[model samples]
Target: MSNSDLLDKKLCEKLAQSASLTIGHDVLITDSFGYVVASNDPDRVDSLHEASLEVIQSARKIYHDAAAARKFAGTKPGITIPIIIDSIVIGTIGITGAPHEISQYALLIQQLAQIFLDFEKRQRSTTRTDYRKKNLLREIITYDSRSHDEAAICESAYEFGIDLNAARIAVKLEEIEGRHDDASEETRVHQAKIMECLLRHFDHPQDFVCPQNNTGYVVFAFGLRSIQPQQYLEMLQQKCLCVNSECLTVGIRLRIGIGFFSHSVETLRQSYENACFALKSIHAGIRNSTCLYIGDVVLEKIAASLPDGICSEISAQMFGRVMQAKNRKEVLLTIEHWFQQRFNFVQTAQALHIHKSTLVYRFRRIRETCGLDMYDLDKVLAIYLLDIRHKLCGQSDSRTSSIVM
Candidate 1:
């Protein structure tokens, strides 16, 4: 801990109160620079105490009598004890009275201060370690091997008992309707809770969660034991459902994405990207469903791999006229649902919560506007491919206005 964080005012005041109650004398606490932080004498707070400075500098106790106190600046007759942690002086605790009268309480007050200082130091150390771990995880998942030394990463992973050769999968959790700023305390609390719940579910030493962005977290779960990848994925999906259900009671919902199993740490980045892609592909129509898998969206992933120009051209050629229609968005959404249902008129209508006749009417309008027969396999394939590209590239709104028939 740094000098500024050595002894906070609240802690100092608590210690001062304890000392005053036990020793029956006015007590004061000072920082390393000798600024009084807490004192039984309310007026003495924030005042400079020269005697405490001397005790800190000398690394020894200072006993001042009435005559000696008069010679020192900002001093009263008292016994001042230096507060030490890890063999370094951090602050001072003083019991005000004549040296002879208050000398007996100096050892007790020093011990009490040390106890609080030690606790604070441990807490700070733990917090620092957690931050380092999070930073390391982020680096491993986001940065390329050329940007960081692979050997050093392996060494660090070994220190944490993480096997670099083990199979792992990346799981991402994102908050739905989470528009709060990243720096807000509420967002931080929510992120912490999400991590806490994930850690509770996967309590193995090799499984770890790291914050991905303002609204999401990425979890890496290594196949340490004998669990199969599919089994692990199912377990994670169930855990996500449970977490989402719990959060719903509090008016928050989470969307979870699971990537395919990665064979080694080198491929973890790909897994993380895949997980994020899957999360982004979550359909807004399925509000009750909270989990998605990369394996389930293979066509979308393939579309994402296509060149941007090719995707744009395909989207323009296939959906141009349909997008120019009055109910462009509705038509596009209906087509998307129809493609998702494998062109089953009955199933697509049921999924869209519309009657079969209404669905047929929409399809007839789409055929007329786009000049593509839905019954033809080649035209259906072309439109389906372009629709996949549009959804994966998030070009629904962008292409609607720009593309022409």
Candidate 2:
């Protein structure tokens, strides 16, 4: 039965008479959240059944005191005897007759309170464990489709006391071709043991580590001192190679996605994207035993990492031209051709499928109309930056349709 159900006024009555206490003789029983579940006192029965600050305040204070005394986490509910339950004490049994009557029953009231509290604690522990399991599973599912970089999620977990920062390597585990459907739970356990052994070299009980997905899995781990992402990738690949033995092609190929520190979930999402991209690029033509960062895969970092001043100036000039151009296509084609040529026209024509002569004609027209050099480095950079800005700004034309008089 529930804690409230167990708190019987009849039991309190019997206890009170047995101990012969005259101290008010009121008994109250309260829930963990401080709602009065049952009580013998009439005045407190109605409003006390609802939650109140007075009840929560008293309950929390008592629980904290018990905790500071080094009591086990699950022991708080039963520790405070005969003080208050729900809100009104269900078993106060105070002595109204004499001081001796009240004193005699004090110990009995205290013991009963402790017993009830202990039972409440056991109930809470069971509930919490169930909740945690569900939450863990939910988080796993949420991340299943995410890129392998999980630093952001791990950082968030750490903020909540989950401690995910250790040297980490991501492991991609696919089931053996023929055995995937038939893989047993025992096989999963064995794999877990293998991973556990790998971690045993560095993991502490407080460390965060786990496998996600089916028996075939991907897991990340952290250790005291982190190895470079590539080294960690190699280590995982080597271990998987050993596990596969001679059947190399049939065994699951391990691709480890490595990520650095991320302080928040947004950064973690970026990392995950990078890792997945790296995996795709690395596996495509160059399946070497090396760690690949997302930035390195397509040289995205280098291309996108324009100097701030250059980027800003380019943006301004491109937009300015776009705003001024009579024909949007003229501006766009000019910019596209300029970059395609590397600011040179002779090469740009061949790339754009236009005649070189036509390209020269366009370049001359662009310079005349926009008052910028087709050969200038700054002008070229401006065209490239503006193109991107125009696209992002969702403008059909970078220039105005009508020129102001």
Candidate 3:
């Protein structure tokens, strides 16, 4: 029943006897605000309108004193007891014709108020618990599912009392060249320490943290200024080091996908895609422990547009031939000149400060090993694609390692 509806017929009848003691005397149940929520007598019920205002003014003082005293004094005469739920005073109840004997009944009324407040508090608490459970489940599904549904996301937000229009980000941790079990355990301990420390800096920082799977997910909702990605990344790296020096390696090795600031979860895929690309681009001789931001990769926009599968294929083909050459660096230097000269033998030799005959001998050897002549248009196209891949994706200093670039 609603709070107003809870004024039982039996309760009202019992209270009415005290209200009708003398003619013109009426029972008034003013809330903590002194407003008459219900009355036994119609004539005196009208007084509640003004009384309620007075009750509210008085309830604040009474509540304050009670807090200081650490006991419920109950609102005194000319005052009303407040019906509070979850630390909030909803309303007050007052008795207009209560006698000196009724003053003892003040405890009884306060006890009754406590019961109602406790019930409301429990109900609201349960509601909030259910809401968080549902939200967490929905986030899991959204993180895994490839498809995006605007309607479903919005509906979930409505049910959870989340503002769908607010900006949010998804963070994930992926382990590379490491065992999943150990990686999972380590990330849990590490992230817990990191979050605990960082939250102390923010006014209010709370996140929906998914467990430490091989790739764990964390969603944070906050203002843009609260998290500057670059600064946060640097700070996180330092914090991870404090957790353990090994954490620095783990942090560097882990692929972190940061979703764009978005209201719609669908667009988040773009961020994940970028992170994956950056992770896989790692070659052995490159900077081992570096944080790759999607924005930095985007700054070299044309680099990302290369045809899929072509770069790896070209690298593989060129690597095989480069390894067989008598002078690997010299061969690469020749190819570099060839590329610079637009594949013109005479021009390439001139650029390299070498004779045309010597360039021809080098080209002949390259043609023998690679099978396809570099002079041919189709082969030249493939070679060009390979060169582009090496410059954009592969590291130049990586040739000595297991990774050939």
lDDT for predicted candidate 3 compared with the true structure = 0.48
- TM values, all candidates: 0.76, 0.31, 0.37
Worst 10 residues of 1 by lDDT: 396-405
Q: What RMSD, rounded to one decimal, does every model reach? A: 5.0, 17.5, 15.7
Cα lDDT of model 2 overall? Answer: 0.46
Task: Give the alpha-carbon lDDT of every model.
Answer: 0.76, 0.46, 0.48
Q: Which candidate order results from sorting by TM-score in descending order?
A: 1, 3, 2
Q: How well is each residue in 1-405 modelled by candidate 2, as lDDT tens digits?
A: 444444554544444344333345544444534444444444444333222233344442222232332433212222223345445443222222223434455566666655655566566665565456445424533564356445655655654355444444333343333245445775665555545544553254543344444333334434225666567555645554554442243343344444433333344334444554445444443224434545343432333344545655544545465445677566566666566556666677776778888877877887787766767766566555444433333334334221110
- Model 2 clashing-pair count: 36
Candidate 1: which pairs clash? none
Query: lDDT by residue for model 1 over 1-405, one digit each (tens)?
Result: 467486867888988988898889999988998888998888988888889878999999978888888887778888888898888888888788977778777897889789987897787787777787777787777657667777777677787787756788888888887764667888877777776777777787887666767687778877645776678778777877887787777666888888878766578878888888788778533222578888988877775577757655765776667556777667667766777788888999998999999888887887787675667756665555565665555544544522332
Relative to the unseen true structure, what is the C-alpha lDDT of residue 229 in candidate 3, on a scale of 0 to 100? Answer: 58
Maximum-TM-score candidate: 1
Positional deviation of 150 in candidate 1, in angstroms? 1.5
| 2 or 3, greater by TM-score | 3
